[model samples]
Target: MKTIAAVMAASAFLAACGSDEADDETTTPDATDETSEETSDDSTDESTGDTIDYPDLSGETIDVASDWSGAEQANFEAVLDYFEEQTGASVTYQSLGNNVATALGTQIEGGGAPDIALVPQPGLVDQLVDSGDIVPVTENVVAQVDANYAETWRDLSTYDGELYGVWFKAANKSTMWYNVGVYDDAGAEIPETWDDFMSTLQLVSDSGVPGLVVGADVGWPLTDWFENVYLRTAGADMYDQLAAHEIPWTDESVVEALEILGDLWGDETLVLPGGAQRSFPDSVTAAFTDPPEAGTVFEGDFVAGNIADQTDAVVGEDANFYPFPSINGSEPAVMGAGNVAIAFNDDEATMALMEYLASPDAANIWIELGGFTSPNQNADTSLYPDEVSLAIAEQLTSAETFRFDMSDLTPSAFGGTEGAGMWSILIDFYQNTDDVEGTAQALEDAAVAAYGE
Candidate 1:
C-alpha cells in the first residue's frame, strides 16, 4: 500500500508546538536525502510490498494556507520540509491565524486560492465544492486516507460520498483541565457522574478554594459548555437535530442543558469571581495564578499550551485533566474539533501536498513535538513526547464517537459572532443564567432568524 513520502533523513523536522505556541514565520527549510524504510506510514495496512509510487515533485513550488500559528504552523512547516526533501519541491506556508476563513474565501472568490488549504469547517468544504472551486479528491489521496483514518474521520472530510479533504489536526474539547496539585491537595477522587462532579465542585468550594473558572474572553468556551451538557443529557440524535436547527433551541432538552450548566455558572461560591471578563488565557493561568484563584478550568486540549506559556505547571504532574463526567449512562460523548485539508489547485504539486498531509508521516512530525493531537490512528502513539500527550491521544481515539465544533457547522450568523449568535447569546446567559427559559427562548429566536435567513 502507498503511504506519504518516506523521506528517510537522519533526523525528522521539528514543526510541532510547545507551550511557546506555533510560530507563523514561514520556513522553506532545505530537504534531507531520501532513504528507504521498510515501514509504511499507515501501520495497519497488511501489504507493505515495495509497489508504492512516491512521485518526485522537485523544483515545483506549492503554497499552503491555514489559520494555525505558533506550534501548529511550525509542525506543519516541518512536514513540508520533509515532503520538500523527498520530492525536491519548495513550499511556503501562510498562517492566516484567526482571520483565515475570510482570507481564504476572499482568495477563492478572487481566483487566488492556495495550492492547499486546511479548512476548519465541513460546511466550508461543502461551500467550496458547491461553488465548483475545489480540486476534487484524487484516487491516490483516497487510498492513503482509507488506510490511515477511521470512517467517521473520512466522512468528516467528505462531501456527499465523495472525499473533499483529509482531517489532519484535531482537538478534544471534551476535557476539563485543572491543576493536578490543587486537585490532589483536596484529596478528591475523579467524579464519574455529572451529579458527583457537581458534588466534587461543592466539596472543593467547601475547602475554601474556588471550584471552577469560567472564561468568556473567548466566548466559544460557553458554547462548548452547552454542547457538552446538551449531548450528555439529550442524546446524540437530539444534539444533531439542535445543531441542524431541526428542533428549536427552546426544546425542553435544550433548557435542561442550560439549567445543568447553570448549576455551575449560577453558583457564586463555586465559580471564580468575574468569569465574564476572564479571557481564555486568563482562565488557563487562573488555576496556576499566584495564590490560586480557581481549581479547575474546562476547555479544549489547546489550553495545555496556554497553561505552559503562562505558568510553570508541569503537565500530568502539575497540570492535568479528566474527561467531563457523563450525565446519562455509558461514556459521556466527546465533543471536539479538527481541520480538513482541502485543495483548490488541481496541479500535481498541490495534490501531492494533500497526500502527504493526510499520511501519518506528516502528522508524526507534530505528534513528536507535543502540544498537538492526531486523530490519524495510524500515527504511532509512542511518538508522543509525554504522558499528557499519550493521555489526550487516548481521549481522542478511544471516544465512543467524536463531533466537530457545533458552531463551526452552523451559519456563522447564529453560531458565530454575527447578530445574536451563540457567542453573544451565551455570554448573556453566563451573565444571567437566572432566566433559563428566557435564555433558551432567546437562542431559539436567533436560530430561527439565522436559519430563516
Candidate 2:
C-alpha cells in the first residue's frame, strides 16, 4: 500500500504533468491521423494524450452485478458504455435488487459469479475476502486509487491489508434537504449548532409549518439520523468503539446523543403529521413538492434525485441542503456510503475495466448526467449539474473526518434487519421519547446479541 506522503507527492507530479499538457495543447494543433496511428502502440497515446493504454478487448465479454435500478441504473450504464467504447469490450449488467448479498452468494455457490460486483457494504467485502471469492486488484488500479481517492475511501475497499475494490459512487448522508420556499416563508435560517437547530425547528413550527419530516417506515433513515448526532457529540473514537461493540450502547455518550435527538423527535409540534410513519419517498416528496408540507427532510444527497424525479421542484432553487448541524463545537464530520466495484475474476478484461472505473474519466461520465456523486478527488466538480450537487461532492472528497454509515459496518441482524436490533430500538424511541434509558438498554442488549459480546 502507498503511504499518504507518497500519494501526496504523486498528486503533485500529476498536477504538474496536467499543467504541461494544457500548455502543449494551447500551442499545438490537433495531431494528424498518421501521427495518431504511429503512437497507438505506445503506453501513452500521444494523439489523445490518454495515460492508460487500454488493450483491444474486442472479443471479451464481462458481466457486472449491482442493486441499482431506475435512474441510477441508467447513469451507471452510461459509464459502462464509455468503457466499452474505449476498450471494445462487451459488458452485461444484472440488477440483483435489494437482496444483492443473497443473489450474489447463490451465483458464487453455483459457480456462476459475475466478473465484477458493485458491493455496497464493507461487511460484505470482508465476507467476500474471507471466503477467498474475490481477488486483489492489479497495481495499475491501486495507483489510480492512491492518486484519485482519499485514504478513508481507499481503506473502505481494503480488507486484511489487501485492496479488493474501487469505490465508484458515494453518498453524503450528513445532508439536511429543505424547501427554499418554506424556509423563506418561515423566515428560517440554516442552523450551525445543535441549539440553533432546535431553535430553528421551533421557529418553523411557530410559523404554521412543521419543522421536520422523516421516513421511519423502513428504519434505515432513523439510523442515519442517530449516526449524524452520535458522530458529532461522541467524537470519532467513541463512535468507532460503539460501532464495533467495544463500548456498550448503554454508555453515557449514547444516552446523551439520544436525549439531544429527543429535543426535536420528542416534540410532536416539530414533526410532520405522520411523525415516524412516513415512507422514505413520501418524506422526500413532502418536503420539496409544491406547497411544501414541512420545513425540511434529512437524508443523503440522493434526496436531490428524488426531488427531481418525483416532484417538479427545481434543485438548487426550490430544494437545497445544508450540512447536518455541528454539535458540541466539533469539527466537521461527514457520514457517507458508497458502492465499491469488486472483481471476482482477475482476467485481462476484468482488470482493464477495474482500472477504468478507478479513473476520473469514468467517474466524470455519470457525474455530468446528474443524480450522482463521485469520491474521486480528480473528478471535475465543475461538471456537476448544480451548485448544491457540487457542494455535496466537494464535502465528500474534502472531509477530513469521514465515517461510513455505522449500521453498514455492523452485522445484518444488528444493523440491517427490519424490526430488530438498532432499527427497532430507535423506532421505539421515536414512538416514546421518554424511554431514553430503555432505548439505550435495548440497543446494548441487541448489540451484545448481534456481536456476541
Candidate 3:
C-alpha cells in the first residue's frame, strides 16, 4: 500500500486533544429503527455477519461542536453525513476552533449549549460536569465503550465512576521519526531500549550529525519528553500523581525523569540548531529537505501528516518511526492524545448518536476513511490505508499502558502557562540542563501555585 500521505491531509487539527475526561449511568433504553430490521450502518463499516441498529429521527436536528476546520472539518463532515444517512437525524456541526472551551462555556452560560460536542481534552468534560451539567448516555453506549476500547480510555472519559464520552480519534506519541537514508549511512538499527537509543544518539553525534530534533519552540514537545521519561522511569501511576498535582514536581521521580532527560539532551551539540526557536512544522520540514540537518524528530503520529503535506519525502522510505525506547526497566508505555465526544443535553436523538459512535461499527467507518485511528479494540484493523498506519495502530494497541500527554493533563496555567509554568520553566531547563534541581524546584513552585495547594 502507498504511504498515508494522501489520507493525512489535514493534520494538526487536534493538537491539544491530548489533555482532557464524562456523563451518566444513563440507563437510557435503546431505540429500534422504524423498519424494525437491522441494516449496515455505512458502506465501509459493513461486515459479513454484523448489522447496525440505527434509530430513526427523521426530522430531529442536533448541534455538534468541535475545533475542526479545513480538511479536518471535511473529514468530520463526511462522518457526520454518514451518520445522518444512517440515523436520519439532521446534525449540524459548528467549528469552534481553539476557543471551543470558551465558546462552549459561553453557550452553557447562556443556556444554549450544543446537543453534543467533541471535546479535545477530558478536562473540558470535567469542567462541564463540575458545573452541574447533567448530560447522560445510554447504558448501551457504555457497554460499547467497554467492549471496544481499553480500560484506560474508559477511564479518561469517566467522571467520578460514571462514563461521559467516546474516544473517536487518537494520535500515538510514543514514536520517533527518522530519515531512513541517514540511518542507513550511520549503519544504525532503530534502538529498542533506552541504553541502545542513547548509544545510537552518540553514534549519530559522532558522525557529526545531530542526534535529535526537539520542536521545543512551543514548549509542549519538551513536556512530551518529560512524560515519556517519567512513564519509563516511574511507571504510569506516578505519572498520574504528577498530573493531578498530588505529587510535587520536585518529587524524586520528577528528578529521575529530569536526570534521564538530562542524560539524553544535556549535550547541546546533539540537538539541531535553533530548536528553541523553530516551530514543530519547521523542524519536520528541515528533516525532509535535502541534506537534512538532523537524524530524527520525536513527535506524535501527526508528524507524519506534517511530513507528507509539507515535503516530498516518502513516508516509510524516507520518513519512518520506531516505538520510543523502554527505560528504567519499565515496559512500553504509550503517551498520546485523542478527541472525546460528550453530550451537552442527552435526549433520544443525542444518546442514540453517541451510542452509535461508542461502537466498533461506527469507529471502523472512520478507520477506513484514513487519517483516523480508533482506540476501539474491536474495530477491524485490516482496513488501515497503509503499513505505516496499521503498524502505528498495532503499537498503540499493544502498548503496556497509555497515558494522555502530561502537560495536557495539568491545568493550562501550570502546563502551558507562558513564562511561569512548565512551559517557560522547561525552556529554561533546555537552555541550562545542569541546574536540574533548580529546574525541578521551579516546576514545583509553579505547580503548587497553579493548583492552589
- In order of appearance, the predictions have TM-scores of 0.82, 0.83, 0.77
Clashing pairs in 2: none
Predicted candidate 2 versus true structure: per-residue lDDT over 1-453, tens digit per residue: 333222223222211111112122211001234423443222342323446667899989999999787667877888888678667899999997655566888899999999999977666777788889999999888987887676756766776578899988888899998888888888999998888888888888899888899889767788999999999999877877787787899999999999988877888888986656877879988887777788899999888777877899999989989999999898887887778899998999999999888876677677667778877666655567798987887676556667777886776668866678777788888888899999999998898887766
CA error at residue 158 for candidate 1, angstroms: 2.5
Model 2: CA > 4 A from native: 1-50, 55-61, 88-90, 96-103, 106-112, 275-277, 397-400
| Tens-digit per-residue lDDT, 67-179, candidate 1 | 77765676678778777767778999998654445678778779877888887655566667777788667887888887667665665566556788888888878888877
Total clashing residue pairs per candidate? 9, 0, 7
Top candidate (lDDT): 2
CA-lDDT, candidates in order: 0.70, 0.77, 0.70
Output the better candidate (1/2) by lDDT.
2
Candidate 1 clashing pairs, residues 3+ apart or interchain: 15-74, 15-75, 16-75, 17-71, 21-70, 21-71, 22-70, 22-71, 23-70
Please give the lDDT score for candidate 3. 0.70
Candidate 2 lDDT score at position 140: 82
Q: What C-alpha lDDT does candidate 2 achieve relative to the native structure?
A: 0.77
TM-score of 1: 0.82
